[model samples]
Target: MGYAQVNGVRLYYEVSGSGRPLVLLHGGFGSTESFAALRPALLARRRLVAVDLPGHGRTADADRPLRYETMADDVAALVGQLDLGETDLLGYSLGGAVALRLAIQHPRLLRRLVLVSTPFRRRGWYPAVLAAMAAQDERTGERMRGTPAHETYARIAPRPQDWPRLWARSGELMRREYDWSAEVAALTVPTLLVFADADSIPVGHAAEFFGLLGGGHRDGGWDGADRPASRLAVLPGLTHYDILDAPALPAAVLPFLTHPVREPT
Candidate 1:
């Protein structure tokens, strides 16, 4: 692992395997270690560039709050600092939103995009999930102690005491309203949207998101010439919380990343 000074923060990242770069971003309150379960398979086929986002894991918190746009900018800068060109980028949950922002805001930086268990609109999430997100604060962080997330944070964070502060900032970011439907429709990347059959976002929203990507429309002809560059997969027997680590995650994504990019028709 090494640190890269970008966007006024020392970002920590780990590089493993060897081949085309595949940058992986973990979820909120999570470090690069969040992808441990998927690492073996991922590293086998491509170089894995895993990063710890601000206020989480080894990366220290900056003075600014955690907004997707800023975080995306940080990530885009990191890619430039690392000299990675048109790489495949995959992000889970909070990371997924960042990946989406990066793809939309820095379209030239990415070759293929995978957003796992992310919603284009805040309201796409279940009402209970939104309530829980809004309720997150320092107390929520304290309550999370003794859990796997806390254990990892305590082991890898620069200042473990900042855990509560991280939660507070994350909660603030989450509560803010955002609707990126129009932005999603305009994306030119060869994107893949992955979600659990049972997820925080309603299943209908998954189809709607795919539709916005020019998918789920008319059937492709026998030659499959009419298919959109974007794809969507709803993995079976998984939930938003666990799908990140599921073997199915890599199984579904590796093909998309390795295949030649399909230009938008």
Candidate 2:
């Protein structure tokens, strides 16, 4: 376990292995432990840096509401603190949004990027669900359960006292919005997009995200030919949460992380 202070917030992180740096960003309502199952395989060939974003895990609560851009800045600050000028980035769900923000705001800080189960647009249903959960938290003062985000909270943040803050942070992120499509299109770093076949965020939306990139047109789908160096892989039979436990996910991703990106023909 290690720690870095970014923007007056104490961020908890862990480092393992020794090679090119690879930073892992867990989704909203999740902590650094979200990557526990995948870290070993990743660490075998790269130095892994997994962090507890503000208001999650062992990190302290934020003074203000959580926003993707602010979270991105926090990540950039951590990169600078470690002196890892240009490193590979892997983010899951909401964390992926943060990763996208980082690529937009500080492109030079990242060499490669990987996003899993991320949504490009804020859905209409999200805010109501988040608000209901926050209201429940405030009324009963008991943490909610059964949701994918809640499951992550249960696993990563076991302490009872930490629940409300995590819940609040999760709500804050859900309510915040950003225009990531245009920003993503401007990115130059090699990127890999992965989503579960049955993910709540439609696979077609992921396809749209891939199209918005510099190398491809939104009209044409990913045909493999004329595909950008950036690629998208939909893991079959997996849902929003299943990707976390999928047995074959690491194998599917490892190759892409190590394989050098080819220039568009």
Candidate 3:
């Protein structure tokens, strides 16, 4: 576990185990520790490269606003710095969006892509969730002071007092509008979209996103020959907040990473 100077911020990353490199991107307000629960199981099969995004965990914030595209570039830079050629990318929530950006913008850098609990468009979030995001402001930080997210930030962040700034900047980033349908449709690498049965994102969007990746367009013939390279899995009895660390997460995800998809006929 160490820091690397990438895209102007000293990004924190931790590497473990051995095999094909798998980069783990945590959700908003979370750090590498976010995957602590699944690390052991995942490490057994693949080398894990977990990271802390700008302003999260031990990584300090940059002067520029935290945008998915910029963070994606940082991740790409990190990957280059580490000489992790053609690694798999897996991200949860906020990280999911960043991973999507990386896959869309830096296509050649990834072998496989996994996005969890993230939507391609801002409108994909439930109305209430969007409303809550819109209401984020100075007061929002104080309201979150004692919550687990705040506690985690306070505990491990280089500047714990920057929680309010992080919240405000993140709020600004989320408030912006974005749609990546064309980009998702243009992706060439194998992809997987994972979501909870009941997540902040609409269930229909999951199918829609998968469809954009050339999935759900036709029936798989005998021996599943017609399946698209992309896959989707919605785990039961989970929610967006805790789905990342659930046992079912890696159980559903690891096989997709290990098993190669057959070509469509």
List, residue by residue over 1-52, the lDDT tens digit for candidate 1: 7999997999999999999999999998889988989999988899999999
lDDT of 2 at 123: 58
- The C-alpha TM-scores of every prediction are 0.98, 0.85, 0.98
Q: On residues 26-130, what C-alpha lDDT tens digit does candidate 2 reach at each position?
A: 876678878878887888889999888887777767687778888899989999999987899999987888888888899889888888887666751245544
CA deviation > 4 Å runs, candidate 1 = none
lDDT tens digits by residue: candidate 3, 59-145: 999999889999999999999999999999999989999999999999999999999999999999999999888787767988899
Instruction: Report lDDT (CA) for all predictions.
Output: 0.93, 0.76, 0.92
lDDT of 1: 0.93
- Residue pairs in candidate 3 whose N, alpha carbon or C atoms collide under 3 angstroms: none
**Which order, best to worst by lDDT?**
1, 3, 2
After superposition, the stretches of candidate 2 with alpha carbons farther than 4 Å from their true spots are 124-160, 214-225, 263-265
Candidate 1 vs 2: which has more lDDT: 1
